[model samples]
Target chain A: MDEFGIIATYFAPLAGDGAFGLKDDAALLPARPGQDLVITTDTITEGVDFFAFDPSADIARKALRVNLSDLAAKGAAPAHYLLNLSLPHTITPDWLAGFAAGLAQDQQEFGISLLGGDTGATDGPLTIAVTAFGFVPQGKMVRRNGARIGDAVYVTGTIGDSGGGLAIFKREKHTLNDADRNALIARYRVPQPPVGFAEGLRAIAHASVDVSDGLIADLGHVASASGVRLVVEGERVPLSQPLRTLWGDHALSRAVAAGDDYQIAFTAPPGLEGPFTQIGRVEAGEGVGLIVDGKAVNVARPGYRHF
Target chain B: MDEFGIIATYFAPLAGDGAFGLKDDAALLPARPGQDLVITTDTITEGVDFFAFDPSADIARKALRVNLSDLAAKGAAPAHYLLNLSLPHTITPDWLAGFAAGLAQDQQEFGISLLGGDTGATDGPLTIAVTAFGFVPQGKMVRRNGARIGDAVYVTGTIGDSGGGLAIFKREKHTLNDADRNALIARYRVPQPPVGFAEGLRAIAHASVDVSDGLIADLGHVASASGVRLVVEGERVPLSQPLRTLWGDHALSRAVAAGDDYQIAFTAPPGLEGPFTQIGRVEAGEGVGLIVDGKAVNVARPGYRHF
Candidate 1:
């Protein structure tokens, strides 16, 4: 099908009120009385982000969820998104259908809707860019530079599961059972961001950041921006059971350096309770440090580098 | 340079207040008391959108202005944008500098700022996706479905100049002077959308659309959505002096069917005064039609198509 045909057949139905049924060039977002809009954009490429053999539905979900993770870290409630897709000629109608289905499923689950988007042809590998919009109360967006001295560092969910999944795809030999294997793979394919915790995080956290890069590298961003030092207790870093079984003793090291965790790593005053683990504390100095046992672990390569 | 380095060097300086110095994953846009946000996105691929030999600055501007045109057509004031870029390994640092310079220049001209974006490595051609945010008074955004019967069709600026430019790049024989040739090429490379006219157009237009696809194709969207017929006088379609020199008598036909004009086209009450030309009228019918010298002109191909 042509671009118009593809949009009409698979995407128009997914568009919501402000999208004008995907017939207009722009979409309208009505102003909220006391809310500030949080906007984030991310683009995922074919080989770099996902294998060509991966399900189209999963690919679509990954593109959306990655941006959603950013909003969650910023304490925003996602409301709408725009999708831009550059497809190679090899893409089939079935693939487009599956991709739209993925978006539809996520929109229903997350309470977000499609606003508007652009679709074009490219000779390159398929690329999907999603721009998401969310809302937070005015002046309440949790920022990276807000971390203060004495603030306790915490992280939501587990870290390194997605990295472990990628390792398995890269031919890592493991005796993991099918369920465990599938769980890890699913984590890589579709991120389960703590979107429900956005309001709470904004209310309590002194500073916040999503762990997209390695835990060390992302915490370093918070540290540099806030001008405070973040020291992590290495053993306190959460790792999935399947990932623990896969890597055993070396899991912590790998997890600390591996990227694509998509979990919120934040800081707040001590003695708080929530669905997070207290992993470290902020200090007066700068930079991020990880303590394993009695010595500091040397991080040669902090995270993935795109060049 | 790595992705982070590239961002810090070239993009961070372009960020504005809500961007948080590009340290955060997401950007915040504080709400305007009585304005509704208008959002639009467009992706441009290397070969499809522009020749690789084109200046990187021009490519960057083109990527931004196309989306800006959509907002202008919707009568929204441009405010901020998110940029997503997938670069091949062959890109040089100089090219990136030029690209950022291009964005910097346009950001100043359009009164917009960079928010946050993603950069990734791709083995394929360069692809840029820009999501622009703009604002209009609450419930005042012109819609494609608001065209009324008996409304007059009007278009801002001349048409087919960009198409003429593309033809020249494709080695189409033309005896035009260097200045004229350069003028056409410039229009193709960087669109000068009628942004300043947005407020006035929104106040007057019954329905509006930007001419990206051929005039017939884009107007057809308005007709289909608004359930009316748009009739264009072929001779009345605006043609630039340089385009007239290039295509002679054939310019009108080519101009009406050419895409990428990035000009606003709207339907409003007859006898209205403005900087736009009255090209046609809306009728109680469906689809779009072209009339030339009292006879109907058949258009086999309506506009540019990507598949």
Candidate 2:
């Protein structure tokens, strides 16, 4: 199909109210009375982000979810997204259908809709860039530079599962059952961001960042931005049971340094918490420190580097 | 440099308010009391959009201006943008610096700022996606489906210069002077979208679109959406002196069927005076028709197609 035909057949139906049926040059975003718009964009490429053998639906979901995760970290409720796809001639109608299907399902699940986007052909590998829009109460966006001294550090959900899943795909030998294997793979494919915690997070957290470039690296960002040090009790950093079984002793280090966790790592005062684990404390210093048992553990590689 | 280093060194300086020095996961866009936001996104690839030898600054500006063109066509004032860059390993710090310089220059000239973005490594060619945000008075954005029978059609600036420039690059021999050759080449590398005409366009136009995919094809879009036919006096379609000198008698046809003009085409009442030329009229029919002298003209290829 041509560009117009592909859009009409698979994407136009996914467009929402402001998109003008994807027929206009631009889309309108109506102003909300007391809300500020939150915007974030991320691009995922074939091979670098996902294998060509990966399910087309999952690839679409991953691209959208990555941006959604950013909005969630900033305490915003996602409302719409723009998807720019650079496709190769090798892409099939079935792949496009599956990709659109994934976006449709996620739109319903996340209460968001397609706004407007551009699609083009490229000789390069397929690339998908998603720019997401969301809303937070005026002046209520939780910032990474708000972490203060003496604040308690917390993180939502487990970390390192996605990294572990990636390792398995890289030919890491594992004596595991199919369920555990598939579960880890699923975590790598589709992120389960704590989007539901956005409102509550804004209400309590002094500072926030999503665990994308590993738990330690993301915390380091909060530390540098807030000008405060983060001290994590390495054992308290949560790891999935399957990941633990996969790597045993070395899982802690790998998990803390790995990327694509997509969990929220934040800081707030002590003694008030829900749906998160207290893993560390913010101090009047700089950088992040990982303490395992009674000694400081060294992290050779902090996170994923795109250079 | 790593992704963080690259962002901190090159992109952070270009960030404006609500961007948080490019440190936050997402950026904030404050709500304007009486205005609605207009959003549009477009992606340009390395080999497809420009030659590899094109100036880095021009490439950056081209990537940005394409989306800016869409906003202008919708009668909106450009405000902010999100950039997603997929860079290959071959990129250098000097190239990045030049690219950032281009963005900085346009951000000043167009009164827009970088909000936030993502940079990732790509195994393929360099790809840039820009999502621009603009504002229009509430419910006042120009639509493609608003044209009516008896409305007069108008277009701003000249058409086909960019396409003629592309032809020169593709080794189409020309006898034009050096200055003229350079002018056409400049049009291909950098677009001057009629941004200042946006407010006036909203006030007068019933339906509008930017002339990107050739005048005929883009006008065809308005015709199909508005359910009215557009009849154009072929000679009235403006062509630059440089392009006319290059293509001679064939210039008019080529101008009407070439893409990337970045000029605004709109419909309004007959005899309305403005900075645009009267080129055609809306009729009680469908599609677009071109008339040269007393005979109808045929367009073999309507516009540039991605697939």
Candidate 3:
């Protein structure tokens, strides 16, 4: 089939009611009264964002979930998404079928649907750019610049699992059992985006950001944006048992500097630590500081910085 | 400098008031009451969409203008856009500077601004996906499935200039003056999207589509979606002076069947022809028919289709 045939056979069904059956030049999304729309776009390229050999379905899920994580950090409900896929001639029907299936699963899981998109051929590796939209109450979005002095910094779930998974996939030496290794790889392949508590975080978090680029690095963004400093008790950060066992005293530092955690790192009043692990405090200064054994330590590597 | 530095230096300043200084994970766009947001996305790849040797600024302009053309076809006002740029290691700071400058110029000309976007590295070709947002009165978007029998079919501007220009770029034999040759090449490089009359089209056009995938193919989409046939007068299709003089009768067919025109083809009541040229009329059958010299003809190659 040609591009239109492929879209009609596989992708058209993923579109929502607003997509005009993928026939119109653009899709219609009616604005709700007293609501604000949040928009974010991310592109994943083979060998850079994901291993070229990774399953197509997992790659599709990862692409969508990463954007969803951004919306979660902003305290919005997933609404819809637009997909721009650039495929190589080597792409097969099975790969496209699996990719579409993955998007369908995520749509059901995340409460969003495909809005509209464009597909084109490329001579390079497969690439997909997803632009996702979410909705929040007017003026109620969680921001990255609201942290104040004395606010307690918190993180949801354990960090470093996805990064560790990548390490494992690269065949780095780690003393993890089979089950742990599989779990780590799964975390890296498909993130469990913290979508359940997005609304709650929006209501309570003084500042929030998703841990896409590493804990210390993302918190540095919060610190820089809020014009404050963050003092993180490195040992207090949650790490997977296997990661901790394998890295020991190095686990916290590694987790704080590794990317792809996809967890929520936020700050709130000390009394409002409802479901997150308190790991630090906001201070009146600049930059991020890590405390290990009650002593401030410098981080040589802040996080992944793509150029 | 890294990715964040690149964004802060070249792209952040282009973001509009709702972009949160390009610091947040997502940008906020508050919807107006009784308005609907129209969304469209297009991905342009290096070498595939444009010559790799083309100017970076022109490439950026082309990428954004293509999506803008879609919104114009939908009869929506350009609002904002998100850019997802994948750069290879070979990209230079000069290229980034020129690209951003191009975007700045268009933002002012089109009355839109950058919202938020993502930047990442790609080992392959440079690829950009632009997701644009626009606004129209609630439920007032001009779609491609509303054409009625006996409705006058109209088209704005001339068709096949861009495609012909591309052929000219490849050193194809064409007997044209230098001024006309440059004009054709310029049309291929930077599309002059007919955006000023979008609202007028919304009020009058029963159905409309941008001539991107050639006239016949895009019009076929309208016919299929509307469940009606179109009888187009081949000689009535407007052609640029140079194209007409160079190819004559062959020019009409080639121009009508070639892609990258970026002109608007619409259907409306005969009394509402306005400024657009009447090219044909809608009929009660299915598919598109082209009449050449009083004889119905078949389009052997109906535009560009990517598989």
Candidate 4:
């Protein structure tokens, strides 16, 4: 089938009312008064972002979830998304079917819909890019530069499961049980970006960032942007039960620096440690420091860097 | 350099105030009250969209112009854009400099700004995807389904120069002069999407589309969407001087079926054909037809298809 047929049959059902049934040259998204739109784009390529043989459904979900994590970090409500797919001729109809199904499930789960997109043939590995838009009250977006001195640093959800999953995927040896191994891998494949807590975060977060490039690197961004230092009590950093059980002695240290945890790390005033863990404190200094056993421990590398 | 450093050094200067200096995970765009947002995305890959050795600047310009053409067709004012770049390890700092220069040139020429985007390393060929946003009056977006019977069909600029350019790029034989060859290739490399005329078109056009997948295929889209037949007077289709000089006998027919013109095709009342060539007419029928020398001409294939 041709590009048009592929879009109409497999992808059009995922489009929302504004997409014009994917027939028009562009899509219309009504501008909401008194709201600011949050926009972010991310591209994931096969071999670099995921394995070529991975399930197409998971690949689709990963592309969307990573962008969704950005919106969640900014304290915005999910609105719409545009997808750009560069596919190899080797792609099969079954693969597209699974891909569309994955997007369909997420559209329902996130209350957002496909607005418009483009698809074309590529001679290289498959690449998928998503541009997601969200809405927040005007001037109310939680940024990365608001962390003040003495602010308490907080994080939501457990960290480092995805990193453990990546180690297993690379054939690293571990005594992780079957259930724990599968769970870790699943976390890597499909990140549950904490979209549910964005609204609540707007009122409390002094500064925020979604932990994709490891907790240390992401907090480093917060520190560098806010001109304040972040001191993490490494022992207090939350970890999943499975991660704690499998990752021997250096679990907390490694997990703190390992990336792909889509949890939100933020700073808020004292006496407002709501439902998240208070892992660190904001201080008047430069760079990030980790405290372990009441001693300042040094981290060799902070997180992933794309160059 | 890491991704953040690269963005700060090169891409950050191109970002507008809404981008927050490229430090935030997401950018904010204020919604204009009483307006609707128009969104479109296009992805171009190395070796597929352009020759691998083509100037990085031209590739970047083409990527943005193609999506800008979509917004022009929809009669919307260009506002902001997000870019997603997946670069192979082979990409050099010089290449990125040229690429960013290209985007910076067009961002100023088009009066749009970079908002927020993603850049990552890829194991495959270089890929660039851009999502552009535009604004139109709340309910006045020019659509593809509003053509009326007896309306005159018009196209902006000239067609077939890009086709001639592609032919020469493929090393095809042509007796054209050197200057003409260069001009044709330039047309193919950089499309000047008629964004300035969009506001006027919004008030006068009944239906509109950008001619990307050839005049015939794109007109077929308007016809199918509008539930009407379009008959093109092939002899009347405008051609650039270089195209006319280089293309011999089957010029009109071939140009109509060649893709990537990036010109606007719209339907308007006969009295409202202001500044564009009247190439066809909308009638009470189905599909699209071409008339040459007072005789019906059959086109075996309407346009390029990616399958």
Candidate 5:
């Protein structure tokens, strides 16, 4: 597909969110009566985060979806976005068409729009960076620094499916049959980001962040910001069957350490509760720890880092 | 240097525009007492735009500045920006340190702060893309479609120095000394964008755009947008002494035809005046033309296209 066609096919659906979506030089996000705007951007590269032989549509969907996950952390609804895509020379027209179609489908599903983007042919590896825009009430955007002592930490969706999925794809030499393997493989390709899940918790969550950098690492950010120790209970740590089968007892540990989860890990005061799984709680401190069987685990390394 | 230092030195100064600047998580721009917000983003890449081996500090500064130039075109000033950087492993620490220092310096100069950014290592070439934010009064943002018939076309600063300089640098045979050559190289390497010039015309110019693409090509965008013919006087085109001395008689012509000037070229009513060069005037109906010796001359191959 041509560039415009690809954009029209894929991004137009998402542009439905913007009052002046992709048609203008900039998206016209009408301020919600008495609210302010919140914006953020994230870029993902092939070799640094994924592989070249990746499923293009799935990857494209995941790229834009994670940005939404970031907004969800702020308790903001999907609005509009600017997507800048740098594609490798080897990428074909059909691939771009398919990728855009997938991205369009995600946009329609998430109720966001593609306002504008810069696309170019590159000799380097594939890269996609999306800058998302969302709006919330004047004082409602959640942040890492909002967690308080005695707050309970919650997460949407089972953690580490993405990481475990990767193992399943890599370790085909193991005991996974075709159907089980494909399901897990799909998980690796496209993360079912808890956009709705996070949205539901917004009414109850006091502070939140998307688990992009893995549970331990991202939770550490919230703890450091809020000046509290997030003591995650090992027993409450969510896990998928594939993850358990792939890494055995180390499954939950891998989930905590694995990056690119894009699930929402949030916090609320001890007495408050809502649409999330309680995996941890906050204590008066300045670091994060993992608790197992009433004993704190000696966790030195937190998780994966981009740098 | 590492990433932090580069941002500190070159980009920190230019984070704001004599106002809120980049001090907050997001720029707290006062929207005309009661107005909506308009935002946009643009990113540049090596190979696609410039070479990586070139002085990276200069590259970092221009990458950040050019994106801000887009905001200026909208009659908006810098607030905050999201930087998405893709780097090849080949970039040395010394190179990156200098780059970050340049970014920090510019951040201070431009009066913006780094709200957030995504950084990653790529097997691909070095790429830097920034999405800058700015706010406009309810109906005060100037757009490309605002040009009107009989409006005067003005250009700030000189053109061709940048494009001509690049041409001179690429020459296999050259005679200029380092100092002379450095001046020419500076135009291509570290363009002094007329961000200040934009503010001066904010109240006067009806339609404007930064001359990132050549003047003719950029003006073509306005012409197409406003549904008018933009006739630009070739001789009135500005040219630096270095460009004139380096290229002689064809200097202005080359500047008019060449792109990537980064100067502001805009249209306003004939009676409306400012400290701008009257390069041409907007005419009635649909195409862009170049005037030389009072006659229409063909302006071939408009500007640079990334695709």
Candidate 6:
């Protein structure tokens, strides 16, 4: 069958819930009345962001999860997405079938159907681009610039596990036991963004951002945007058992600066919070820093570098 | 410098008219009253879409034009764009400067600013993912499903030139004189999209499509969408001098199937005037076909295949 025929047979059925599926020139999903639409796009590259030699299902899940995490940062629910998928010429029919199954499973989990997008074969490495759009109520969207001084710094779920998980998966110069190793590996393979928790905090949290990069690195984004000092308490930073068992000396720095955690790091005023575990406090200072046991520690490294 | 700093230094300073520029979580542009927004995205790969050694400015222009052509097909005016650019680690400082300049130049020409997107470097081939947005008044937007059985077929500008140009440039088997070579090479390098003509036809055209693929293939899109058959007069298909000179006996078939022409191919009633040239008429049938002096031609090709 032709490419269009294949798309119509397999993909078109999944897109029926969309206002304009694969039929129109572009998808036009109607926004809920009195709501603002939130859009975010992320592209995954082979060897850089992911690898084909690895388990394809894991790669696909990570791709879908990372994009979903972006929406979670906005405290928005999953709605629909556009997938621009490119494949290397070496891709076989079986690979495509597996890839499509991965996508179907993710769509089922996230409750977002494919609206419309493009497909092409390239001679380069595999690349996947996904743009997820969701609806958020007017004046209720949490931004990175709404943090206030004296706000309690909060984070849902633990961090540094994914970074440690990556270290174990890559088999780099790291030491972690099997139980700790497996836990980290799962985090690396699938960083679940706390979508429900994010939605639950919409009315409480002042500002939020997802921890794709490390804790200190991503907080810098909020601090810079909100124009306030974020002084994270060293003990307030959460570290996993695997991280404790792994790097004894560098654990704090790694836990604070390692990325790909996929957890939500947010801020709320001192005592008016429903959810969110108290970690530290936003304060009047210059930029972003960590106060470990009442002393400022030098941030030697920030986080993962995309370049 | 970091990713954010690099953008602030080189790219952000160049984007003066963007909705939110580089400061927000997402760029918000207000859609015009009484008009609907049209959006499309295309990713250009190094070896698949263009040669890696090509001029960066030319590549940028081609990337922007491809998405703009999609908007032009819907009779929309260019508004803004988002770019997710990936590069190899081998880029020099000088090359980065040139690429930034090229983007700045095109942003000025199209009256669009780079809103917000991610950029990273990897070991993979260069990939440029551009999403362009345009606007057209509601209910006045042209689509692929408006063709009627008695309407005349029309096409703006020339065809078959880009395909011929590619052949000459890539295949050293052919040689050309300086003037002819320049014209053919220009056609391949920068095929002009009929944006102004599309806007002019808003009142007259029943249906329209930008002829990225050759005539017969694009016409098939209309036939499938609108459920009407179209018969093209083979001799009436437009061709440039170089294309006519290059293919000779096979010129008609080549013109009908060659892709990347990027001209506008539309359909309207016989009595319509402005922004369109008569080629043939729509007929009552199931599929699109070509006729020459009342005789059918068995042309077996349909546009360029990405595979």
Please give the distance, in angstroms, between residue B21's alpha carbon in candidate 3 and its true position after superposition: 1.6
TM-score of 4: 0.98
Q: How far is candidate 6 from the true structure (C-alpha RMSD, Å)?
A: 2.7
Give the alpha carbon lDDT tens digit for every residue of A1-307 in model 4: 8999999998899889799999999999898889999988888778766787888899999999999999999999998999999898999999999999999989989999998898888878888998898999999999999999999999988899888888888887568889998888888888888899999899999999999999999999999999999999988899987777767787898799888888899999866756689999999998899999999988887798886
Report the error of model 1 at residue A208, Å. 0.6
After superposition, which runs of candidate 3 have C-alpha atoms over 4 Å from their true positions?
none
Candidate 6: TM-score?
0.92
Sort candidate 4 into its docking category: high
Give the residue spans of candidate 6 off by over 4 A. Answer: A1-6, A16-20, A30-33, A173-179, A246-249, A272-275, B14-19, B29-33, B172-174
lDDT tens per residue, model 3, B183-256: 88888989877988799999899999999999999999999999999889988898899777656668988898
Candidate that scores best on DockQ:
1
TM-scores for every predicted model? 0.98, 0.99, 0.98, 0.98, 0.90, 0.92
True contacts kept of 1: 0.95
Better candidate by lDDT, 3 or 6: 3
Question: What are the lDDT figures for the candidates, one per model?
Answer: 0.92, 0.92, 0.89, 0.89, 0.72, 0.74
Worst 10 residues of 4 chain B by lDDT: B43-52
Sort candidate 5 into its docking category.
Answer: acceptable
Point out the worst 10-residue segment of candidate 3 chain A by lDDT: A244-253
Candidate 1 at A244: error in angstroms?
1.6
Pick out the ten consecutive residues of candidate 6 chain A with the lowest summed lDDT: A24-33
A1-307 per-residue lDDT for model 6 (tens digits): 4456556765676684532547655544432556656666777878666657756677777877777887787777777777677777787676666666777888888888887777777666788887766666765667788899889888877778887876776777455667888887788777778876657767677888888768888898889888898888888677777787876778888888888887888888776555456778888865788887799998876887876
lDDT, candidate 3, A62-111, per-residue tens: 99988999999999999899899899898999989999999999999888
Question: Between the candidate structures 2 and 6, which one is better when assessed by TM-score?
Answer: 2
